[model samples]
Target: MKESNYSSSMTGLELAREYYFQVGRPMLEAQFPEYLPKIAAGLVGDGSECLGFDDEISRDHDFGPSFCLWLTKDDYDAVGEEMQHAYASLPGEFLGFPARNTSARGDGRVGVLEIRQFYGRYIGAEQPPKSLKRWLYLPEDKLAAVTAGAVFEDSLGEFSRIRAALAEYYPEDVRIKKIAARAAGMAQSGQYNYGRCMCRGDTVAASLALNEFVRQAMSMLYLLNRRYAPYYKWMFRGLRDLPILPEVPPLLLRLVRENPLRAENAWKAEKIRNPYLNQADERVELIERICVGVIEELKRQSLTSRNDDFLEAHTYELMERIRDPELHMCHVLEG
Candidate 1:
């Protein structure tokens, strides 16, 4: 009942999945067969396991056997208590591991939680956001967390719909706005700040600038593709999946770790002292090339928005394009 990606000690997701398939799910089937049809399960979400980036460090607290059981409001209200009793009663130990403590009988992100409560914590209402504004404004991690982890049962299919809807790419104007802002930051931090810090003899500051540049550029790539950025640790991992600007992460990382400012400057100094020390011109040329590519990546998105607020307003229109909603609000008003 363990996911292959759960190669480490065992992630919260892995433990949850194990608990669901091995213990919790079987209990439901035998004790409450009728309610089974209204539930759904499995993991496809925001945590480190959902992305396969989890490791030994994930074992501190939330890491353990767990799973989600999603139900519509109608179904949840009817059998929620019965399910809770059954869930709590499931053998608290699996293999050699024991279930951890949660705030409630069932909480997913922390200890273990029922699916409905998990959704309610993030969207401010169980079920998914019904409006584009709700989707735009909702934190990507919250949405990711809700849909993430494994689901052992999903009979009504409501959870799937919400996940699919949330999975959609952002609106064009929103994408443009986010991309523009992030790109501007990347330019300022990576292309501009790194060099400034280096000249001021502040290698630490320069390193910080490179890190910032890497993050902003990664966010820009996610925006360009209309995808949500994952948590910071997996930001580069997330960027690698984009069909657009796929090479950005590797090149950026290379710039950050391999060609750090101190190393590059030292090389330049040696080259200046002796005609044959090293290739100073090459380092300068490479940096300019990186900047040029970054600027061009910003341009290719065709995002014409000027600022973050402008991007925020236009995000929904882009969503309409994605969802092809039955009736567009602005269009109705104009008509």
Candidate 2:
């Protein structure tokens, strides 16, 4: 297939949608009209495209005009293979773009897929996990993927139903537990250990501690906003759109980018009292500011009533709000 010189501001998700309507839809309507109403078509699962974060760099591989066609188990068992063949016969190029260069891991990303199999690959279940333990243990990024992308049509409703249930975000008890974990993590890594590592001249350990603090802080922001953070690569992009703690991102960025210790002062514990020490002190103060912002949100949400700058204190208070006996008794960091 030859690539055209065509260029547009279209995102991968938009390209997939247009491809489905212009080519995939017509073929399905002509060849399998009887099953049209039962089929679900959209661009979903396992791609920067699915998350609406794809760009020119995303097109070099596992990209281009493609969308998923999901079918119920019964419909799949009957026509899954046949439908895939029909899908393969669709135009290799659409809107002047070449066909998707599907890598080995991307084979199932496009074309006909069974609904259960499609979800199972992401969340490790045919349906959303029902038990609290299952919900707590499932990875947040996987849950994000399960609910990402646009479902253009789902006449049968099975696929959309699962997506909707997962999209409701975590149950209240589970969310509280997760928030408690993040609070404890931020307290331990940022508030407690960051300055200690800097004082001890362990810059590597100090950097790692700051990274942990940032990770925990980001997760806490998402939980506070009642949204799932996407995979780490797209986290900042996702974070930018979150309604709560909008100021926290810039502080987190400064925490990661600004190195408090100068090269001459690094790994020199005896020189801790130098001018560079003030930079480290500023980062610690910044971390405290973030903690304060989170604490304010926690109070507003009635998740905690603590009046402390230390996040570990609030962690216990948040856990106390958990109504489930089993969950409440579990370790604050279990989630």
Best by TM-score: 2
Candidate RMSDs in order: 7.9, 2.8
Per-prediction TM-score to the true structure, in the order listed: 0.70, 0.93
CA lDDT of 126 in candidate 2?
A: 41
Candidate lDDT (C-alpha), each: 0.57, 0.86
Q: Name the candidate that leads on lDDT.
A: 2
| TM-score, cand. 1 vs. native | 0.70
**lDDT tens per residue, model 1, 1-335:** 23353333565566667767777778878987887776776665445766656676544444445555666667677776677666666665565555543444334443223455656777777356665555556676565555445555576777666666656655443444344456456556755666666655577887787777767766766676767777777777767668876666667766655655445567555535433223342323344455455555544543222233222233343334433343233331110
Residue 217 CA error for candidate 1 (Å)?
Answer: 1.2
**Tens-digit lDDT string for candidate 2 (175-216):** 999999999999999988887777676778888988999999
